[model samples]
Target: MHVTDACGRGGATPPSRWDPAEPDPVAGLLATARRRLGMDLCWFSRLIGGAQVIEACDGDAAAFGVHPGSTVHHPGPHRSHALAERPLPVVGRIRPEAVTSGTATEATGTAATGVEATGGPLAGRPEVGSYIGVPVTLADGRPYGMLCCLSRDADVAMPARKTRSLALLAEVLSASISDRRSGGEYREAAWWRIWRLIDSGGPTMVFQPVFDLPSLDCVGAEALARFPPGSGGAERWFADAAAVGLGPALELSAIRSALRAFTCLPPEFGLGVNASPATILSGRLADAIADIPADRLVVEVTEGDRVEDYPSVRCALGVLRREGVRIAVDDVGAGYASLHHLVQLQPDFIKMDQCLTRRIDADPARRALAAALVHFAQETGSLVLAEGVETARELGVLIGTGVHQAQGHYLAPPGPLPLPASANRTRPPDTA
Candidate 1:
C-alpha cells in the first residue's frame, strides 16, 4: 500500500472535494457528524479504481497526515467498510500491535505484532488511536464511499449510540448526493437539446390569422412556434430552455424563425410575434426586426415572471415604438400582470385571454368583463383583440362588446404560411 497526500506532494487532484467557504449540503453534514462523534477528524473517502480518494474532510486534517484530495492505496477503515459483506465492528482504542510498528502498552501484556503497513489509515499515521466509519451507498445499493471519524487519543470512546448516529448521517448524505447528481445530469441533457434546436435554425413557424371582428378582413397573423417532434409542447420547450439559462437565446431563435413569414404574408397585412419581457430588455429585439419595415411588425409581450424594473422595460419598448414597431399586451384578462403591463406599456393592442373569450355568449360575467375591457382599451387608445372566438355566437358577442379583432380555431387554425383570403361580409353584424 502507498499513502499519497496530494495537497503536499501534488498527486492526482481529487475530482470532488469540500470547500469550507462554500455552502454545500455534504460539507455541512460532515461537520455535523464530526462534532456529534466528538472526533478530531472526519472525512469522506470515495473508492475510485481501487484507491481511497479523500473527497471531503472536517476538523484537523494536517494532524492526521491526510487532507481532502489525498489518496490512500489500500487497507484502511474505509476500504474495509466498503468491501465488507456485512457491517464491521467499530474499532475503538485500536491496539498498537494491530495498527503500527509501535510496541504494545505494558498494561496490555502483548508484544509488538505490527501488521504489514502498505498505504492505509496507519501508514505514517501511528497517532490515529480510535476509528469509526460506515459505508455510503447509492440508490442501487452499491457502495459509493465511506464516512469515517478518527480521534488521536487511544482511549476515545465509540459508544453504540454514536456508531448508530454516524450510520444514519451516512444514509442522509448518500441520498443528497444521489439527488444532486440526478439534477446535474438532467440539466446537462436539457442544455444539449436546446443547443441542437438553436443550431438547427430554431422552431417551425405557423400562422394564426387575426381577423377584423366586423368586416372579417384578415388584418394580421400571430406567428406561433412548433418545436421538433418529441421535444414536447412549445411552451414546455421554452420553459426548459429558460431553466438552463438559455431563455433569451431560444426566444430570439423563435423570433428569427417567425420572421420568415414576411415572404408569405400579403403586403397589406401585418405580422405579430411573441416575446417575453426579458427578451425585450435584452436589446436584441430591435436588431431582429431592423431590416423588416417596423410598421409591418407587432411585438406581443408574453410574461411568466413579473418584471421588477418597469422603467427599464418602458425605455426599451419606447425605443422600438419610435421606430414604427407596435406593441400588444398579451393575455390581458388572464392575470394581474397583464393588467399591470397594459397600465405601464399603453400598448397598441390588448389581447383578451382565451379563458375570457371561450364562452362569453353563455356567461354574462365574461361578457360584462369583455365590455369593461373594451371601454378601458378605448380610453387608453388601445384596440381590444378577443382571442379564441370559436363560434359565430362568440364572434357576434365579441363584435357587440366592441372588440376590434379576433382569432381562434373557428376562423382558421394555425397552419403553414400564406395568409388565407379575407372572409367576405355583406354587412357588419348588428351590435344592437
Candidate 2:
C-alpha cells in the first residue's frame, strides 16, 4: 500500500475520510487505548474505494504520517492488506534494516518483489520502530477496518493479554459500525422524519410536575419532548438523529421548543431540561436560554455519555452558573461516573436514578442509599430530587428521607400542550 502523510509539507490539502459535520464517535476509544497502553500513537483505518484511509487517530503518531484523511493504496506489500485478508491481530518489532532494504517481514506478509523491493510508501519511516494492530470486522465477518498502535522504540513488546484487550475494543468499534450500517432504509426514513421535525419548528413539549416533598406542592416541571404521531419515543428518535450526525441540531431544536414553555409556566415553577454534556459544552444551551431567566432553567446533564475531559465540562458549567443557569446531575446512582460528576460539578440539583428509587419503600438497601444521597445533597446545599416515584409508599419514603423534591406519575404525569393553569398547583396523591 502507498502510505502517504495527510499533513504533508507545501500546504497541500489532504482528502477527508469522514463527514466534516459529524463528530468522530470512536475517536475517544482510540485515545483511551493509546493512553492506557502507553503507545506513541493510535489510529483507526477503514478500507474505502479500494484504499485504506485513516479515519481517526490520537497522539504523536500524527508526526509519523498517521492522520485522518491519509490514504494507503491497497497495492503490493503492506501490513494493512494482510490484516484485511486474514483479519488477525499483528504485533512485532520493526527491523529498520528490513524496512529500508525493501524486505517484507514474516509478520506483515508483504510481497518481497513488488513495492517492498522498490522502497514503497511504508518503507524508510524510521520513527515506526514497532507496531500492533487488530482487525475491526463487521458482525457478518467482513473486514470493516483496523485498530492500530505504533511505537518509536524498536525493542517495544506488548503482552498477549494487552493484544487481546485491544481486540475486544476493536470488536466494540465493529459492533457500533454494524449498528450504524444495519437497517439502512429504516434509518434513512427515520432520518428524514427527524429532519422534517426539526425543520418544522421541533417537537412538542410536555410538562411533568416536580413536587416539594414536605409541602406536596408543585415546585417545578421537567420539560419532556413528545414527537408528532408515529415518530417513535423521544429517546429512540434522538439516538437515530445522533447516529446520523444531527444530534446537536436536533437537541438545539428541542431545547428551543422546551424553552417556549417558560412563558406558560407559573412564576414559582422552575423548568428543567435534559441535555448531554456535549450539548452543554457546545455553548448552544447558553445561547438558547439567553433571554429566559437562568434561575428558572435547570439543565440536567444526562448520564452515560463518556466524558473525556472533566475540567472542560466544569468550566462550561461554571460559565452557565454565573448566568444563573442551575445545573442538575441526572441519573445519579446509575453508574459510578454519576457520583464523580456530583462531586466534580457540585450541581444545584441531584436527581436520583429511577432504578434506585423504583421501590425504595420496600427495599431497605435502596432506602439507605437514597437517604445517604439526600444527606449528601443537604451537605452540598443542593436539592435532592427522586425520579420515578410511582407509589404512595415510595413518595412517603422519599419525604421521610428528606428528599427536597420529586417527579413521576405518582405525583403528576406529564401534561399536554397549553398546560392547564393548575399544572403548577399539582399536589401529591393522598396517602392517608
The lDDT of each candidate is 0.75, 0.73
How big is the positional error of residue 21 in model 2, measured in Å on the Cα after superposition?
13
**Lowest summed lDDT window (length 10), candidate 1:** 105-114
Please provide TM-scores, in order, for all candidate models, with all chains considered together: 0.80, 0.59
Give the per-residue lDDT digits (tens) of candidate 2, residues 1-432: 222122121211222234355555698899888877777888888866555677788887535544677664433434445545655566766666766654424333222112232314455565456667777888888787778777776644456766877888898888878775665556566666766677677788888888877787777788888887765798888888776546766777788888988877778778888888777777667778889988888989887467889999999888889898899999999997788889888999999989998988889999999989988988989989999988788888898988988888876789864443332335655464
Off by over 4 Å in 2: 1-190, 417-432
Q: After aligning candidate 2 to the native by TM-score, how far in Å is the CA of 290 from where it should be? A: 1.6
Report the number of the highest-TM-score candidate.
1
List of clashing residue pairs for candidate 1: 1-118, 1-119
lDDT of 1: 0.75
Model 1 stretches with alpha carbons more than 4 Å out:
1-23, 60-128, 152-157, 423-432
Cα deviation of 401 in candidate 2 (Å)? 0.7
